[model samples]
Target chain A: MNVAALGAAELRNRLHGDGLVYRVGPYAVRLRSSIDQVLSAFSCLYADYPVEPDDGFADFHVYVHRPQNLRRWYRPQAIFEFDGKVPFKPLPFSQSYPFFEWGLNWCVSNHISNHLIIHSAVLENRGQAVVMPGNPGVGKSTLCAALMLRGWRLLTDELGMLSVDDCLFAPVPRPVSLKNNSIDLIANFAPEAVIGPRCEDTVKGTVAHVRAPADSVARAAEKATPRLVVLPQYVEGANAQLIPLSRPEAAMQIAGNTFNYSRLGLQGFATLTRMIDGCRCFEFRYSRLDDAIDTFEQLLVGGEG
Target chain B: MNSGTHRWSVLPDTVLHWYCADDETLVYYEQAGTTHLLTATSAEALRFLEYNEANIGELVAVVSQTLTLDVDGDDEFFFLMEALVEQLQKLGLIEACAH
Candidate 1:
């Protein structure tokens, strides 16, 4: 792969004095570091598409080699880089960050969309996709990771691209970001799961990326009409519970949670209405991952009550 | 204050609720807080919201003379006006003027 032939090296830098340049999409981005760092980030996120050259003008190109560079690049509306830092507040250390590169990819991809990009997990069973959209500590990712391990096809462990018009969810299928106890929990719960190295002292405590099941990666582009849009809040020592949500409530919730819902204007509204009409909305509270997975599986097998 | 005072600028003749704000345009719904994206025709009706309390008789005259109504004579035109008005009222964009 001739790197120069693909994209014009836009930005250049040297990491630890290593001459490194990144071909962003179609444009070659020059940076200061080993391409290994960039490749590592790409691997963490599971970006299978080829390094497209001179893809033309991008929204922005940035480089992250130092720890403090994390704070500097935080404001990109849409970000694309790999750095070890925790995005969640009350910064959890002791545990290393898993999949910093994957996390960065998720941010950039989600930001590019003219829809609300949520930090949630999405998975599909049967033909319909179940999207769990919410904040970082919601256990949405854990549940998403577990289900994917248990034969549910993973669409995304972090972002769900939902079109309001057809109400269909396009698959992102990135690596699942598991933190602290989640890393161990999944390892113990499903020994077959592929858990990555942990990066310490960032946000959300110690973090790691769990590689998506191979079947999911193969079918990463599968699109499904969202059968359900759920907001899950996980609590320790509590039983799993699924609460019903009305169409109006769902619409409002999605609108509020959507990253760029208001940005797409009429198109966004139309798409959102279509999504709300097509799917059932719910608010779930669960403590145990297996129980949550079972309840969702049951709903998929039978019509929801 | 007066619901009928201001009609949604984007939605012309049909009923509308100025429900959402977008980057460039505003989202006007045919019903208040409802899910339906106002069809073009319904959006056209939103133009009538610009008028301050125009009655069905006035609207029919305007819609008919200014554009195509697809209806027969004055009676049918009046019926269409009434229906449009009813939808507008449902959307909370217009009210029947005391006059």
Candidate 2:
């Protein structure tokens, strides 16, 4: 049964007790939260995600709630608890939903070692996956979301997962986070896109999440073969183009953007380089999403990306 | 500088891993757990020093030959050679020994 089948009241009831255990691709997470905004977010952003059996094993036990003591009465804040340890200080109570998203990302990146997790976005079209590694403000997530709207299957909007043994991308299709101008940009770009509640005055400016497409959520267990590794940049008003990046440089760039490269050591290096060697790498720059989509479309269709 | 007083050689093959693409090379130093991108010249220089501990002059000969540049007192080549050696040594991929 998906979360939507539970209805808001029953979902809220479960969250108040032993928690709602749900699968996020490769891992199962048991989430406990009583905050209203966070509760509503589950219905809006996570409606399509199926609910696992309550007694099933969960990889992470997380909580988002007001602190127990008098601090909760003061400036009303919500703290994230990961298996009873507070990983981060509280944000305003209104930001609980985004905080939950960020905290879950923290849990995945910090705890998992079986995969070479790079801070990237993964999308697939015609069975070929592309991993785009970029720093914040590079608009990789925006590009990823736009592609998904154009019929590409979104593997993830963050945390590109490549297995250490096989280097194949394990899909963890979660909501695409949008911020500032991107919120309006996506709204304008695709009027039919479903966006969640907006959290104002957050650290990353006004932020919201676009729900992952139902098709992507349904096929979360599918792994993808990487064929293109891209370093994306949003250059204002520039023509969208895919510039060829040398294999050595591509390896370095991917290594630099990785979250657990040092922890994985030589195994990580071998995995990253093998993927780079097998794939066609590029440094992609664009201003308009339409042009970007066209450029990617041409690459996929012409077989010369 | 008194760089000529010491001989430099690459670390043993066991401690270093090399990946070549086109004219560029990426080397991973196992001890330092770091990867480095090297130019064709640096690759040639390291290739020469991998077999024999040589001073800067010998390294310049191999690297210049690989680049097909004249080594007849060309200041630019010498400067680039010295800089490349400095970079390789900094990465712990190469070290200087007493001649």
TM, every model:
0.61, 0.95
State each model's C-alpha RMSD to the native: 10.4, 1.9
* Share of native interface contacts present in candidate 2: 0.55
lDDT tens per residue, model 2, B12-74: 663667788866888887777898898889888887877788888888887777789877888
| Superposed model 2: Cα runs more than 4 Å off | B11-14, B64-75
In model 2, the Cα lDDT at residue A284 comes to 95
Candidate 2 lDDT over residue span A165-262, tens digit each = 89899999999999999999999999999999999999998999999999999999999988888899999999998899898999899999888998
lDDT of prediction 1: 0.57
Q: What lDDT does the true structure give each of the candidates?
A: 0.57, 0.89
Q: Which ten residues in a row have the lowest lDDT in candidate 2 chain A?
A: A296-305
Q: After superposition, how far is residue A125 of candidate 2 from its true place, in Å?
A: 0.5
**lDDT minimum window of 10 residues, candidate 1 chain A:** A88-97
Clashes of each: 44, 0
